[model samples]
Target chain A: MSLAKRIIPCLDCDNGRVVKGVKFVDIRDAGDPVEISKRYCEQGADEITFLDITASTEDRGTTIHTVEAIASEVFIPLTVGGGIRTLQDIRDMLNAGADKVGINTSAVLNPEFVREAAERFGAQCIVVAIDAKCVSGPGEPKRWEIFTHGGRKPTGLDAIAWAQKMTAYGAGEILLTSMDRDGTKNGFDLDLTRAISDAVAVPVIASGGVGNLQHLVDGIKIGKADAVLAASIFHFGEYTIPQAKAFMREQGIEVR
Target chain B: MTHLAVIDYGMGNLHSVAKALEHVARRADLTFKISVSADPKVLQAADRLVFPGVGAMRDCMGEIRRLGIDEILREQIQHKPVLAICVGMQALMERSEENGGVECIGLFRGEVRRFAAGQHDAKGELLKVPHMGWSEVKQRAHPLWRGIPEGSRFYFVHSYYVQPHDSAEVVGVTDYPAPFCAALARDNIFAVQFHPEKSQDSGLQLLQNFLTWSGHA
Candidate 1:
């Protein structure tokens, strides 16, 4: 059972165009979401995630259209999040061709929403997106807190504990993002990623800190993440999905 | 035109499957027509049928009975070629242990069993359930496997594995740390636990073969 490590290129879309930023700020235009996603699929991306960064009520319709356009062309598994606050939004995303829905803010606000969504749809379709940042300082032991609203608000909940709760609540997968490493091009927070990966039984997709192919390999090899989701590098054409996959294959890591 | 229908019982993402079939058909330049419908008449008229499902076994079986899809599948399986994927394949068993226990269509003598808790690979590390990723499926010489190579990887996302009563009914096997049925074939019926639509190149080839198959060995 060689389950290939998945390489997912995340599209931070707002309105209709793909955007990129550092720690969920300084958003810049990348390209059309559909075109970029289609390119990634051709490049052997295992999956694609489209997050509607601008989660306004008015812009919700446009995001659905973009998800539809992308899914109509791209055959890979598509997960959509941002502004997905209710079961109806989840149903809309699935109807828009999303195979999974990532819930961050909503899941934190109403934990039972996760269980309800999973029961109504399926556990395979529910993805809990966790944006965490290390709060541990000098004398304090290691601790990470969950952040919501693009990392602007702290939930006072420990990231690891929340992940365990989310899993028990029926979240089939976890999209763990380190707010500090996001868009830094440094590397994934291997410690935090591994912590959550070890804490949960479901698949963990490490996101928010990839600069090169080696980082992609480390996300799985070191952090023990089941998948890696990256932006910027793939969006700007610095490295294609195939290039990263080749790097993983050379690293002796299975990728599809 | 060669008409194909993918059975839609409100349990799966049929759009992607339909799109993949259309893409493969266009690439192969075959005169194929495909649609995702729950109507029995549309399914009866098609040259081929695909039964695709996801979600819990209990809900899937509930919907199958609520819509009379069980009768449709049972009657059609005898004469026409049918393909099932994921939970669609699990529902083909006599019963599933999921949701405590759920009775299924009973088209075959097999029970869907959940992966024992705390499953691990050779490394002594625990393996996750829902087995969500691509795994190399070991083929067992079947007509539907026509052009697909041996040990080709296909996308799989499931927790329960089907245990067929007859070994010959198994057409392919994959290990989630242990060997289990990955693909099955019986007469005009061909079903896989993986999502060929999401699997890429080799997956498209398998779909192409199904389109051309004559429901005979």
Candidate 2:
């Protein structure tokens, strides 16, 4: 059999609790990060991602404890992103049992950080998280730009070129999130996903908009993503990971 | 109590590996005194050994040499049930083409090679390096494969793979466009290119099998 396309359920953690918000607004508590992660593992999630959205510096420590708790019980790959600005942050997350650490704003702010982190920690554990927003509109030449600060600030870097540069800088994987389609319950930006997936030699994980199981399938079959990461569909009890996997398998996609 | 020592050389995280073994041990109602350390005395006194590593080959080899784990591994593999995972498996090979080529432990007469650039799968799609994700493992007859189904999916995250001099030493094979040795078994030593701790059910089953495996083929 061939390599299975991974289905990852992302948990947005705030002050150690799992929370969900539409377009990063009107956020509501879901449950405990550890308990939610264990449930996802039981439901056959290939991996679990925890993005720390805590605003206060003191609350950041809570995310580490949360990760540690889930890592002790959940025997699957766990990735921690958001606020991963320093090597100490990366080490703390890995020490807390995270398999990989995703860097977003830091990589754009200092491209050399990706290289240094990769050399020190190994490329296998360093994932570059890119929040991309399409800048070109209607029938024009399609283009996307990298955005930081939860898609609020624009970096003006071409998404495709940045992805290539990151991989060149030794990023093992690319976590691409489409800011335009995120939280819209629409689907992934197939064009954006395919572009980055084909641009880099490292595995690309398609994140952001995944409204249904069909979206997940398209992320692989059409988007060419090696893994699909979604929050709302699997987080809000709208669908379970097993249902998603079963649907994907029915569509002739290999899944674990 | 059976002492299970996980050799840690400051290479990668060993928390998950130790936790998984403890998880399986509790489930199977088996008592195992699991220790994650680099101490020679602790390793020598252990009944079983697990060598788990991640990162560049040169760094791993450097630490192994600094900690004198190379000598300990050489001695332990003679009789104890030893399990090497991921880069730990690659380290057992004679040399690797990573970090401008690094010499390995040479426990097995083989070389570790990187997945060449511009490789394609059957569908003509370009394959990625670091070959990260879950892939089916074609199993051969081995005690470590016990309880785990043949052709089961195991989690893999590596760019380089092992090539043994003797094909008969291979216990499991997987394809990332091309078939490579996924698991190698010889005498009491069993090495794998995937992470059994993060592999969910099939992986847990493999770890469970490893816990109960006798020092024999």
State every prediction's TM-score relative to the real structure.
0.96, 0.97
lDDT tens per residue, model 2, A48-132 = 9988865322334436777788889999899888888788888788778889999888899999999988887778889999989
Task: Write one digit per residue (lDDT tens) for candidate 1, span B131-168.
Answer: 88889999998888888889988888787889999999
Which segments of candidate 2 are over 4 A away from where they belong?
A55-62
Worst 10 residues of 2 chain A by lDDT: A53-62
- Model 1 compared with the native: what TM-score? 0.96
The TM-score of chain B in candidate 1 is 0.97
lDDT of 1 by residue, A1-256 (tens): 4788899999998768899988788988999988898888888888899888778333343378888788788877888988888878887787677888999888988999999998877788899999999999978878999998888888899999999999999899999999999999999999999999999999999998899999999999889999999999998889988888898999988776
- lDDT of candidates 1 onward, in order: 0.87, 0.89
Model 1 regions more than 4 Å off: A56-62
Backbone collision tally, model 2:
0
Best by TM-score: 2
